[model samples]
Target chain A: MLSELDLSAIYLTLKLASLTTLTLLIISPPLAWWLARSKLFFRPFIESLVALPLVLPPTVLGFYLLLSFSPDSYFGAFWIQLTGSGLAFSFAGLLIASVIYSLPFVVQPLQSAFVNLDKNYLEVASTLGFSPIKTFYKVVFPMTLPSFIIAGALGFAHTIGEFGVVLMIGGNIPGETQVLSITLFDHVETLQYEQAHLLSISLLIFSMSLLILIYGVLQKRQKRLNDA
Target chain B: MPNNMLKFTLCKAGLFNFAAEINLAGVCGVFGDSGAGKTSLVRALIGLDEQFIGSVNFNNNVWQDDKHFVKTEHRQIGMVFQEPRLFPHLDALGNLTLAHNKRSLYTIETLAKLLDFENLLDKKTIALSGGQKQRIAIARAILTAPQLLIMDEPLSSLDAHSRALLLPFIKRLAKQIPILYITHSMQELFYLANNMLLINDGKIEAVGDPQKLFIDPRLSLVKHAHSGLLLNVTCLSWDETHAMLQGKVDGQAIYLAMDKPVEQEILQIKVESKDVIIATQQFPHSSLQNCFTSEVEQIEQISASHILLTLNLGKQKLLAKITAKSLQQLQLKVGQSVYSYIKAVSIIGEIT
Candidate 1:
């Protein structure tokens, strides 16, 4: 009865979600902090560019990444001469596209969180004898942890549901880039209704659970603040 | 105790350009209005803003000078802000230990008990009251074992009733570290300050004892009035035989037949200038019992109906408000000595 299960899609979806969440975690902090605290002339300009992914079509972004890394392109030619392999239609290329597609999901919440933080914390941190870097790590980072967690969870869930960008850049490489959403579409096109239903139910349940986790943690923090 | 000499200019308009030389051991209060540069003065002292000119030298170590600069962390100064700004992520114990420098004075449990943080250690900062948060912030600063402690209107955030509770902790803090408390309230200054710097226009207008100089309200009112000092009275015993009150004004004790009773341990009479009767020669059977021999310190007209007489009875200052017509008739001069008599009923307040 359970023979219609897509084991490969399940594995690929988990890998993509985990890798995308991990990479965004590393990339979002400094970018979010810069957007939150920087007073540079290029700050607003850079901020608008980071937010461009939010408004731009994911297919368009995926198409550009696919072209840029194709074997016939300059980036591909350069990579061929150096590493000797183009990233087009590869899992790595798909991951890069996924990062760009989910950029604002990971960053906007964190930037807002940093903005909401007490500015006096940093001032008092310096006065209390912590260096600038030490203050950021010891004070700013710890205070913004809840935001980071929520951002990571959202990015992970977003990447898990990704279909358009993965199809464009990944090209449905079985066991490699064919994530869950793409496989569910493939099952439907092939008249495999049972297979589609199984993958769809799993994706729905997984996304719901991740969202509930984020809400639960955020609510707990709010309750503690109210009680205090 | 060596005085910490610090000079700094504030290009910022609202703050002051204070050049204060003060002792660092006792509680040093920078008293002024909100925009009078109280916080700016403390911020400059602690090296939060090094852009200003001049230097700060504490115990021969210079924190800031024209050619060199030291950051706040390295300055060894502890700061407690008005809002407490407790680290919300950390519990009370963690908040207290955030700035511990691992010096000999490092005692987390001791401070927790002293600050009443025992029951609240496991509780999150969001669970604490406004006053409790401030206490934690103060404990965090103390844990650092800073050389100088700076408090910028720490009490200003609390309610009037809450301030009464915290005043004792601040008063007791004088025994531990030198505090620079910034405040605009005259009541806060009167009770809290031991040594004060009267900050006005971002400059040190006056620096001296809190009780001695706060005289006039507009300028020196704080210097004089806020002191609320003791006026030694003689012969406070009730006279049962004469069925009257007995007290002395200048030196000798006298009897009064006034109906009202002075119901407190101490009495302060606001010697209005009009009520006083000056006698050329010592009047022998006068109805006024409170008579004193005093020399005039200054004769200045305050209003059309009121002239202030600054009389000196020994070391005590006697301010009497009289009418302009009375001054013209008496021909009062600055140096002229005279015997002035006062009725016992004019005294306004009595304190136990």
Candidate 2:
């Protein structure tokens, strides 16, 4: 039911979400692991910082991201120096914003999973001659795989449904930056009711199918684990 | 030889303070009450506690000293936690092979056989019962073939039947490596410990043979109601005619109703002080199988209502806990001769 324009927006949205989720999967674990185990005085402060996006208005975060992505700002200048292009109004800028906005969704689940992990398993592994890094790879990571999957799926879904952050930083560049959420907004704004209905239905179906697939796989794994 | 021992002296900011220098030659039992620093000491020894100032020299290597801090993996130690601590994501076999050292003599199959849960190797740890998981935990630790094995109250969480099933395997493991066995239970010490260290209020109270440590009146273990004396015994012969298995304690003959033949000649027996009855005169036709005449060595008031009499039976000593009223009625006195009556079945555990 999607037109060629609508299809391009869907592809761009998937690309941004995929890139953001993959990057987050790599970046969030170490931060989440530290949050789970750190006893430093700044732990709570850092935790609140990571969780700020959960409570802050999307536009508020988008406004700050917009400022940072402006070529005049140091962060934006450094990116241009490295990549030979300004960051604002680009797909790259939207990717960065989506990552920061979806960070808590990726981190909190993994953090709690690590926190609830029984430390004795690591101790026993250590005494058995498994190095710390090896134990994490073989024991800790595998044990918490379900949580990691859930975190990744949540980050991906959150990034796909993101609008305000993408809108502010990306500035409605049709081929380069406009995503599915922005496209649907454009359709509704133009009173193209039929196109809006198709876009809305597709996004709804996509998000619901993703959640169902992830949660369904998790349930089967949990049942198998319980049975075994 | 001077540095071939586990020596550590640590002073912590709070929680626990301990210092001990002892050879890890056999089963060195760590005995203590709950929160008495037994766990803290073991954790320090294993390099799990970094908040302590200390030097731990193992086999002449500086594990933790003024200049070096070796990690637990490099220490060649295998640890069994009070809980199984198995990886929930792994099956029993996976756990056994998680850190399998190539130098290990005991295969996973062999350990599973010893633990008597061979059928469970393919099962996920989450599906196993506590006892079953603990059995796998023990087998998993053994498969690592560590230089020193530490077990912290491994049997405490297990049921009595599981404890019984596992006790023999523990005693068997003692022969394979220098073991550090930590337990608050006096009875468990008798099963595995060759030498014992008593910890109380963040200090080492005593260090000696388990039998000697148990009998030391100053130990916190003696104050407990379950306190008892452990003795080494040898099976002399089986009196098949009377369905009695004869054993000896300090060359003195004792009879027990042992239906199955004991595998080892040398065994350890725990005799609770309350189970021994004192009689002034010996009776030939008494119902009790053990009636040994012995001199009263010392007397201590255990509680307001109880008098603990230490009896010297030949070269060995036995404790008899009787009421102050019974002491008065029997007129028991130090250096006086009296018959000590121990029933044939009162010995709850016999470890070989």
Candidate 3:
């Protein structure tokens, strides 16, 4: 049912989503924790910057990323000198764009979780002789498992369904940067109704199943807490 | 002065400003009203609140001074919060092992037995009741092998039956480590705390045995509920025949019709002031078993209708709250000899 271009698009999309989700999970926790806990004067400014992707047009963000990754720019030139390849129109460039676009989806949930955490747990943990970092890993992190899962799922799904940002920054290389959304769009433009319908149905099913799984787990956890 | 005792002087602008040199040898009760900053003192003492300018020295090791401050983890202090701050993500066993120090006196097995919650070891902390969670929390704190244990109203969240159940375990644990107990409950104070520091408005108002503070008229404003005399007594003999225990306080004999034997030798007894009756002459025909001649050492009026007669029974002190009519009828005065009658069951509190 699928051609070579379609299969490559699926693989590239999955790779992008997986990499974006993994990188965001590692990068978001400390940033979110700081956003939740720090009292610095610039905290709100940093918070707004993190949340900008949530409200700003994805095309606008992608335009900025495209500009920054161009060969003419300092950062883009550094990337080229180090890696022997230009960042623009590459899978690496697409990955960076997806991460930035999906930043808030990963961060906001984790930030709220950290803010809602009972500080007495940390205090008593310290009194019980657990160091601060050990306390976070052992007690604080486990307690917020539901939020972590929700953040990860949202970030992964959002990256998979991404369109505008990739269109602006990724430049649609057939096997490298052209993801499923671009492929579906290409099928529609060429009047390939069957392929377009297939890709659309698959994306719908994937998104629906991920959402159902996340909500089901969250509801089960809520019921358990209420029963407890 | 042992080096093991904790002494601190903390100064903050608005929230807390207090200083006290505490001899942490026994259950040192931090007794105060709701806004007395007892919790702040605990936070500063444990190094949780570092904004205060102060020095906290324990075992001659400076925890906080002008130049240095030890973090909470290295302080070797265990804390039981007002609520059981147990990890909801972990089972009782897991929570206890989270901060397990290898050199501690207890393992998960022994700590479960110590707190009398062996059946709850495998249960999730969120599934446990308040009392059960508190028991696990205490065991978890003890498993860390802290040099000092700080319990901030650990029983306040529990029901009366639960309080009665967990109090003995707390009493037992106090013998192993010096505890800094913070509570407004007079029952917990009278039962658990021997040495006490009374806090008032972020200051050390008084520091002494709870017994003395209970009767000090100045404390009537704060602890009018605790109108009683505390006596140190020993269970001299247990008469299984009469279902009674022969107790001695200040070398004077006293009898208790207790169904269970007092397991410990020394017992702290509370005789309420209102329960004692004062008579100018001894009643030989009275059915009361605790009638003794005592000399009135002082007299203070506690209220418009009642007078507090402080009586010396041999070397031990006793207080009798009598009506103004009774005082007028008996014409009582200081240094006068009178008979004090207390019902056998009136020793309502006895702590080992």
- Winning candidate number (lDDT): 3
TM-score of chain A of each: 0.92, 0.97, 0.96
- Sorted into a CAPRI-style docking class, model 2 comes out as medium
Name the better of 1 and 2 by lDDT: 2
Question: Candidate 1: how large is its RMSD?
Answer: 6.1
- What are the per-residue Cα lDDT tens digits for candidate 3 across A30-133? 99999999999999999999999989998999999999999999989999999999888999999988998999999999999999999988888889878778
Each prediction's RMSD over C-alphas, in Å, is: 6.1, 4.4, 3.5
Encode model 2's per-residue lDDT on A72-147: one tens digit a residue.
9999999999999988999888888988999999999999999998887778778888877888899889989999
**Top model number, TM-score:** 3
TM-score of candidate 3 versus the correct structure, residues matched by position = 0.88
Report DockQ per prediction, comma-separated: 0.64, 0.64, 0.71
B229-329 in candidate 3: lDDT tens per residue? 66666778888888988888777788777787876666666678888889887788967877767889877876899988878887567888889889999
Ranked by TM-score from best down, the candidates are 3, 2, 1
In model 3, which regions exceed 4 Å deviation?
A: A222-228, B159-161, B217-226, B232-245, B256-270, B274-285, B292-316, B321-339, B343-352
TM-score of 2: 0.85
Worst 10 residues of 2 chain B by lDDT: B343-352
Candidate 1 lDDT tens digits, A1-228: 324247876887788888989999999988998899898999989898888877878788788888888778988778778876668877777788888888899999999999999888888888778887889888988888788888999899888888888888888888888888888898899998987887788778878887898899889987876776
